[model samples]
Target: MRSTLPTFNEVWQRQCRSSILSDEKQFFSKNTFLVACSGGMDSMLLLCLLHCLFPQRVRAMYVNHQLQPDNEVWATFVQNFCEWHNIPYLIKKVQVAKGNLEAQARHARFNAFQQTICSEEILVLAHHQQDQAETFLLRLFSGAGVNGLKAMQKIAVKENIKIWRPLLDVPREKIEQWIKQDSIPYVTDQTNFDEHYDRAWARHTLWNVIKPRFPKMQTAITRTALLMQDADEILYEVLQQDFKCCGNENSLDIQALNDLTPARRRQLLSWWLKTEYRPSLDTVDRLQNEVMYARTDAQAQFFVKPFWYVRYQGKIYRLTEQQKKPKQYEIEIFDCQNIVLNQKYGLNKDLLKESLMLYPRIGGERVHLHGRVGTWPLKKAIQEAQIFPWQRDQIQILKKEDVILGIITPQGFWLAQSDYCVPNGWLPKLDGVSV
Candidate 1:
C-alpha cells in the first residue's frame, strides 16, 4: 500500500523537462536548490519529493522569523527531518519588522535565501494549488485587477532568486494521500485555524461557498490564472511601447499619461505596481489614483514615511529626502558661522572667505601654475588641472591685486603659485573639526 518513490530520472524528466537545459543528460549547474521548508505539510511534501529525486542537490532552509513561540519548535522539526535523512539543512533566525506574520515570515525567508544563495543557485518553495486558490480568492476580495488575480506562477523569480512550485498542479488531497502512503510525517501550524486572521477564516469560508456553488471553481480559477499570464504578456508588451516613448518603470511621463484611456491607463499603472513595486496589488490604486491625482504641486508624495514627496513643474516628480534647496546664491564664505551643509558638496578650504579677485575663466585668462614652467590660459590650466564638477562651483581664483594667480578646480586640488596652497601637514583647525 506504500507509495513508491520515483527514480531520479523519472522525477527529473517529469518536472525539469521544461527547463532550459533541453538535454538532461548534459552538464547542469550543480548549485544547491535551496528549499524554504516551513515544517508544514506542503513544505514537508516538497522536501520529501526533492529528497526522493536528488537529496544531494537540495538544501532545506527553515527560517524562524521569531514571531510565534512555536517558531523554534518548527525549526527543530525541519532540522531533525534533515538530519535523519542525511540531507544538508540550515536553520536561520530573523526578526519581522512589520506587517502580518505570514507575509513578513515569507519575506524574511526569501530574503535569507537570496542573501545566502550564490548567483548560480535557485530557491524552491512549496506553494501548492490551495495556496494558489486562496491567493486568487483573496485577490478577488481585495478588488485586484488582472495581474493580482493571475495568482503565483509555477516558476517565478523576484530579484536574484528563482521560486519554483512543482506541486501547483498537484492538489492538497493528493499531497495528503502521498504523505500518508509514503509515511512522511508533517507538523501543522496551529495558527492556520485561527479565525482572527482573514486568511485563516477565508480558507474554510471561501472554499465552502465556491465548492458547493461552482463545484469546479478551483479548476476554472486555475484556467483563468493561465489566461491571465497570457494577458500579462500582452500587457507587458504594451507597457514596453508606452515606456519607450515616455520613460522607464519608475519614471512615468505625466503628459502622455493623461492621453491614455482611463481603463487602459489603470491597467498600465496596475502592471507597473504589481511588477516593479510590491508583489500584491496593495498600492495599485494609490499609485494610479490618489497619488496620481494628488498633484505634483499639491505637496503629496507616495512614500511619505520615508520623507519622499512628489513635485510637479508640469507633471509629477518624486522628491526624496524632504530636502529644500536653500536660495543658492554666491555664499560669501566671509560669514561667521561655518559652511553648514546638509549633504556633501564641493568645498575648497583654499578658496574660503578670501579677498581673491576671482573672475570666471575666459579664453584670454592666463595663470602660472606653481609646479609648471610658464603661464597658460586659466581655462587650459583648469582643463590640464583636472578640476571636478562639484569643485568647479567653489573654485578659488587667488589673484593678489586683480591678477589671476590660479584657480582651485577639483583637478587634484591645484595650487597655482607656491604661495597659493597651504603647506602640507599645516595644522589649521576650523570650528573644532580637523582640516
Candidate 2:
C-alpha cells in the first residue's frame, strides 16, 4: 500500500506546530517572521500557515520577478488576499535581466528580501523536500562535490539574515493537499510547467522518469543530503585545524601550506576564500596543481571576486586594487595659533604659514626619522614598520614650496631627510588615506 498524503492541517499539526510552539522555542520565540509570498502555491501555503500560527507577528512580501505575462495579475491577487486577511504586505518589483533567467530572478528576489528584512526578523521561504532533492540531483549530475550536494538547509543565514524553511521536510503533495483543502487562492506561473527551464526540465523529464522506477527516491536523496551536510561539517572542523597550523587570519604561509597534502591545501584555501570569493572546483584544482608548487620566484595571481589572490614572498596575500589618490593636495591654513589639525598632521605654526603640500607615495622618496642616522627609503621604512601592502601607497609626504618638510606613515610623523629641527608644542597629524 502506498503511503497516504496527509491533509494540510494534519501535516502542519504533525510536522510544524509542536516544534514551532515548543516551550524552548528555538525559532519562533522572539524574531519577527517575514513570509516571502510569490502568489504561488508553495509561498501562499507558507503565508497562510504562518499567519494562522502567529498572525500578529507575521508580515508578508510579494516579490514580482516580472518574468511571466500574468505576473501583475498574480501580484494583485496577493495584494487582495492580504487586504482581506488584514495582514501587512509589501510588494517589490524587480527587473529580470537576460542570461540565466532563473538565477538572475533568484538573485534579485533575495536581494529584495535582504534589503527589506529587519535585523530582528526571520525571512521565511517555502522550499520543500522535493526541491532539495532536485537541487541535490542537479548538482550531482553537474559534478558538484560535497558542498553542493549538501543542498539547502531548513535554517540558513543569508546576507546576515536568518532564513527559515518550515516546510523543508514537507513534500509537494502535502502542499498541494493543503492548498486544495483550504481553498487557498494561488496563481500558477506557466513558465514553471514549460519544461524549457532547467529546473522545470528536471521536474518534468528527470523526476518523472525516476519517480516510477524508484518510489522512495525523494526520501533516499534527502537522507543522502543530510549525510553530506554532516560530512561537510566535519570537513569544516578539519579545515579549521589546518588553518591554525598553516595560516593566519588574513594570509596563508606558503611554506607551512606546502607541508599539508594537496587535498588539504585545496580544502583550506577553498574554506578561506568561501567568504569573500567563491572559487570554483576547477580553480581550487588549479591552485593546488599549478600555483602551490610553482617556483618561489614565480609571481602568480588570480582574480578572486573583489580581490586578487597573489603569490609573493613566502606567503599568499589577498590584494585589492587601491584607487589612486591625488599626487598633491594644498591645505589652506587660517590663523596659525588656532589651526585645527588636532587629530591630523602636527606641524609648527611657521610651517603652517608657508605653502604646505601633501604628496602621496610616488616611489623613490626618502625620509629621516628623529634621532635616525642617514636618509631611509620610504618604501623600506614602511616595510620595516610592517604595514600591509595595500597601505603603502597611502603614506603622505608633507612639503613646503621647494623643500620637503615631513612625511606621515600610519605609524607616526617623521621629519624630512635634511631637516631635523625640533619645535615645541607643534605636531602635524596625518589622516593617512582618504583615497
Candidate that would win on lDDT:
2
**Model 2, position 217: C-alpha lDDT score:** 96
lDDT per residue for candidate 2 within 236-328, as digits (tens), equals 888889999987756789888888887888888887777643468887777655566677666566665665676656777765554212223
Runs in model 2 deviating more than 4 A are 1-12, 19-24, 275-277, 288-291, 323-348, 356-367, 375-382, 387-404, 408-412, 417-420, 425-435
Show the lowest summed lDDT stretch of 10 residues, model 1: 425-434
TM-score of 2: 0.83
**Candidates' lDDT values, in order?**
0.62, 0.74
Query: On a 0 to 100 scale, what is the lDDT of residue 229 in model 1?
Result: 84
Error of 1 at 362 (Å): 27
The per-residue C-alpha lDDT of model 1 at residue 366 equals: 66
> Between which residue pairs do clashes occur in model 2?
344-429, 344-430, 345-428, 345-429, 345-430, 346-427, 346-428, 346-429, 347-427, 347-428
